[model samples]
Target: MAKKPDWSKEEQAVQAVQLAFDLSNDIQRAFRVSAALQDMSTADMVRKVLQLPYRRARARPRLTVTLKDEDFELLAQKYRLDPQDRAAIRHRVAEELQGFARNYLTDSGH
Candidate 1:
């Protein structure tokens, strides 16, 4: 019988290291705008611009953002949803975004 090889060390070796960049506000906003226009996450856009290989796209596409109390209040007013009901507020926001994309994003989905 042969002894099994350890896999924990190999797992750590293959793990990706996260990196951070301290860019100016204007540059950050520009990157974000470019990514949004291309329907990509900012990280993916940056990697593509640098010609770096990146992981494949997820099975299900999604957009994520952190909404604070003030954000919720504003969204509630604009969406006429109950601010206390976060789920409803989030669903409405998603619906609104879908509407915006359906209306504005070109047929190419860009």
Candidate 2:
């Protein structure tokens, strides 16, 4: 003799109803058409719909800086650098200042 499996039919019915309600319009229509012709659980229909993955855009690296508001505004006005050349300009300026200070201090000998 084969034993019958115990099934929670009431919980399954509630889950089916909930999944049907949550389905998109196109999927819901497909589900309804499938349901009318055959015995299909809403969970199965939803699983079919869920085969399409949610696409997320790739993340890009970003730079952020923090400064005193007044100092930031003053620096912005003083430099007025082109966005593209700003890093290069800063590098050149720092190199030149270091060289000048080194020469001046060495020559002074005090």
Candidate 3:
């Protein structure tokens, strides 16, 4: 008699949901390559990509800032961020500044 393999609780739970799809060879190959590059299973990659919330593009106000080397270095160290990743740095700074403004306004009863 063949022995049955054991599965972890998480694996068992995931196994309960089964999704099957038929794709063209080219599409399948593309998904396989993408999944391999990301070091994830095809199913997991598909699930993650499908689960992301869709957002429509809209124009938003932008802020521009010029920083000296010393100031940039200080901000990078304080945020524990990479200076080369300008987009991430900008996003973090914007979020922090917005939060600070909100807190200050609330505290001042404005």
List TM-scores for all candidates, in order. 0.55, 0.24, 0.38
lDDT of 1 by residue, 22-66 (tens): 999999999989877777778887898899975445335687899
Model 2, span 75-110: residue lDDT tens = 545666543455554555566567886997799675
Residue 27's lDDT within candidate 3 is 91
Q: Pick the candidate with the highest lDDT.
A: 1
Candidate 3, residues 1-110, lDDT tens digits: the string is: 98998889998998786778898999989887876566666665676689853323213334467977777677788889886766777778899989997898689675
Please list all clashing residue pairs in model 3, or write none if there are none: none
Candidate 3: misplaced stretches above 4 Å? 1-64
Which candidate number has the best TM-score? 1
Off by over 4 Å in 1: 1-16, 22-53, 106-110
> What lDDT, from 0 to 1, does candidate 1 have?
0.83
Best-to-worst order by lDDT is: 1, 3, 2
Q: What does the lDDT read for residue 16 in candidate 2?
A: 54
Name every residue pair that clashes in candidate 1.
none
Task: State candidate 3's TM-score.
Answer: 0.38
